[model samples]
Target: MDNSETHNQRIATMTFTSVYPLYLKKVEKKGRTKEELDQVIAWLTNFDEQKLQELIEENATFEKFFQQASLNPNAHLITGVICGYRVEDIENPLTQQVRYLDKLVDELAKGRKMEKILRGT
Candidate 1:
């Protein structure tokens, strides 16, 4: 398989709980609140606080986390670069979805307004 496919597989295996703290720290350091971070995540994944907590407690991997997600219909509206890749142009659906979240978190830490961050959804 190609290197990208291999890379994607590795990313998919990463646990959400493991990465969630980093996301939280990033936004908080930027003077954003946990509520705001959660809001951004909810906009993308449709996971309520309870469900999100459960996922974290379960140490769910990105693959499993997304499998249980009810992805927002407007997810396709997310665009731009993340980790040197254009998120909207990613061919792998899982990879694209993960990058979508990454892009959103980046925007939040960058102090983007929620309306635009949610892509006016």
Candidate 2:
């Protein structure tokens, strides 16, 4: 009932981190294949806060996310060729997305805790 508790609770349910769950719902409706889902998971392993925001700001359709997933370094083996066009400059949303994703993947590679916090983990 205190301000600190309320702030902590709000942070716990952050929408930014919820993007993965939202993507999960769309995966089935979008008719994604297992291979594609694998690509998605691989890309998610690379997800970081900055990249998630950039993707959203670009009004990046699921297709754009999928395209970027294909190029993700960690997911590249599964994604095969990198089809998405690259943008130079961190100011560019796409570039920022890629940068964050790369950082995220690096963190995961080190076996760091993936979730900042889960509802019931």
Candidate 3:
């Protein structure tokens, strides 16, 4: 299988709760707030704070979390490289969505303004 397919399978089984704290640390170390992270996540996944917490608490896998997500209509606007992969260039739809989330968290950590990170929301 291609790298995207391999990657998809790997990440699909990774728990959201396991990855969430890393995202939080990445942003916080850059002086960004959790609220900013939440806003970007909410923009992409349409999960409110309470719902997001529930998913984390449930130890949802990336696949399960995204399957339940109401992806924002503007998610295509998120285009960038994350962990050396271009988010827009990912072949698998599910992997692309996951990368989109990664890109958003990356931008948040890099101190991007929230409005722009939300694609001008």
Model number with the top lDDT: 1
lDDT of 3 by residue, 46-83 (tens): 99999999999999999999999999999999997787
At residue 73, give the lDDT of candidate 2: 48
Off by over 4 Å in 3: 1-4
Instruction: Output the better candidate (1/2) by lDDT.
Output: 1
Segments in model 1 whose C-alpha atoms lie over 4 Å from true places: 1-3
- Backbone N/Cα/C clashes per model: 0, 0, 0
RMSD of 1: 1.8
For residues 53-100, could you state the per-residue lDDT of candidate 1 as single tens digits? 999999999999999999999999999888777888888888888889
> Tens-digit lDDT track for model 2 on 1-121?
1225544344333433345444444454555433343343455444454665676676654436645554444332222111232223333333344434444333334434434211112
Cα displacement (angstroms), candidate 1, residue 48, comes to 0.5
Candidate 3 collision pairs: none
In candidate 2, what residue range of length 10 has the lowest lDDT sum? 78-87
Q: What is the TM-score of each candidate against the true structure?
A: 0.96, 0.27, 0.94
Which pairs clash in model 2?
Answer: none
* Cα lDDT, all candidates: 0.92, 0.41, 0.89
